[model samples]
Target: MKNEGMERLGKDELSAKDSYYINVMRGLSILRVVLVHLGLSWFYPPYSQYIGIFLPVLFFVSGAVSYYSFLRAQSVGEYLVKRLVLVLVPFYVFAALVLLITVVFYPERFPSGIGVVSWLLVWPNFSDVFFPLNQVWFINCLVVMILISGPIFFITKKRPWLLWGVIIFSLVVSLLNVPFPLYAAVSEYSFFSRLRWGHQAWQVLVLLGLFICGSVHYRYLAGQSAKKYALISIVFLIFALMGYFYSDLGFELKEHAKQRSLYYLFLSFFAIYFLLALERPILRILARMRSLEWLLLYTNRYAYSVYLSHTLVLFYVEQWLGLTDLGGQPFLALVRMFLVLVITLAVAKPLGDLSRTLAHTVRAKLLNGIIGGVRT
Candidate 1:
């Protein structure tokens, strides 16, 4: 009954249709996270190069979803604190634990993991340090972007042109390489670097585009037709495939720009279209087997926890299988990926469930106290 809060939010706060899309998007995002990591070895040459295109799109979708939630929230402080507990707290805790493991338990990998100091302090680059939590850079970026966009969002609530103006300005700055004061000048840090992009100003430009797109979809779009959406998705998929194999774009740039922006656009459209096309049949099937619904609900609820813990499972698997000693071969690599995926799911399931339960309990307590005045 307590979980009915979602249904209530659907009926009262947001349109039922909109809430459903948000849930579907969340589920798809988690699935893509698994696929991107799991199938990394299996990806063909060009696809391999552009393998991580879905990541930024995840953040953009997060921006959209969180923006809606922020509108429903009580205050910015309350919203941010809640998100910190849900996202950042777990990330840092897991990061620390993994760092401790690598440093204290297996000292050899400590150097490898700790080598990510530049990523932590300077600007973002691919570092595998405390990978489970550290890999959540996308989510961290989303939270930061939302915080920065708050004022702009509030001011441009009904003024569409102003939001558009901000987005265009940021993009132009990126193209022109104008050194905006938007970047942080924390040169005193121990890991400062001269990286031009992924700095504050550069990130602001990327985040601004995502924010504007999310707002546009939220306010004006009425969702898409299924067939039309599928066509659009297929086109994007073709582009992704082409970009991976034929395009001359570097992996990093493709991951950040082409892959993310295009994937987000296509996938969002596809999901909306697919669900609309299947709504009646899907609802009927779910109604026929209510248990299936609970299974899905439970998996989705703990998806973030699973994502945050899966990498440790992979690292341990590598150690257990003596993967470090073996030279990489196609067959052996495939075997390793399979073994790691299985182990990761096995370990992530229970841990993820426990995390979800604890999160739910805390949320329930907070909601109770909010609905009922605090006691002495």
Candidate 2:
């Protein structure tokens, strides 16, 4: 809570209004992440299908938030250091712990064993490989977005037109069916291809588009008409859904073709601008719930941990509860959802806290002995 020595562009923290939006969006992102994990192999139509549509918005919000931090930081070094220490450090440690657990306990998933240190070094594996805590793709993507936001901010600073052009181009790419090859050695039958982007060019372009939107938000949108921005968000959403649905009409178009660049762009704008647009109403509703605030706050803080661990937890929980069989019974799907939601929150949050505390204690002792001679 005490963000000392963390100076930003104009303020040390977001405005109360801005904080409200951030909190709401953060909560929404976490909710979707949970839903996706639970919905896996569940209902196939409509609601069961929107998980893909829902998760990308989190990335857009991430780009927006990271861009805000980038502008506020005194220097690039400060930005990178703070983000990595606070965000990336916890992510990597928790992910590694997950890998350790799966290899030790659920060896069926890790055929190569722990000796493949090189695999851990690569991030795409965070999504493709299900060792222990497997839902870490968002963190990896956000890390990539944060690292590049600076150059994006600088490049699009003076040229607003250029930024829009890049966004539109990325949107075009999203509408087209183009596979970005990341690995050639993997068997074409391998599941790894699903996780790897065939085109880094489009990925970076889309990230920049989101970054620009986030930057423009700070520079201009904040003080402007919330209604207008909300309308923009709505219009973008309509186009996104159109792209998503229409991609199947052509051979060159693929289902969910709106993913890479266009999806992040549209969803980022939709979540952010609409959030600002609905600031007053949302806060009033959320403020009424006193006890739930802690729950929301807890999720916001340890969301990365929850995201990392939920899949493995679900793996065990499904087996124990026999909920996967309920996929045939639509009503039972709801019951399973409720059960998974409760059990996951109960298990993941505390486990995440314990993991962080242990890591912190170990680091503290190691540093104290080196710096203070055991407090003589």
Among these predicted structures, which one has the highest TM-score?
2
Give lDDT: candidate 2, residue 334: 82
Instruction: Evaluate residue 287 in candidate 1 and report its C-alpha lDDT on the 0 to 100 scale.
Output: 76
Q: On residues 1-376, what C-alpha lDDT tens digit does candidate 2 reach at each position? A: 1232123234534566555566666766786778766765245554455445445556555655666666566556545544544555566566566667767876766635433453444353443355344455446546666677666555654563355665565566554533443223222324544545433333454445654555455444554565776788799788656654554333221233233534434655565566667766766777898556666666777777666666766676777777776656878778777776777677766667766776566555545554465346
**lDDT score of residue 329 within candidate 2:** 83
TM-score of each: 0.64, 0.72
For model 2, the run of ten residues with the poorest summed lDDT: 1-10
Q: For candidate 1, give the lDDT.
A: 0.52
Q: How far in Å is the alpha carbon of 113 misplaced in model 1?
A: 16
Model 2 Cα displacement at 52 (Å)? 4.1
For all predictions, the C-alpha RMSD in Å is 7.4, 6.8
- Which consecutive 10 residues in model 1 have the weakest lDDT in total? 180-189
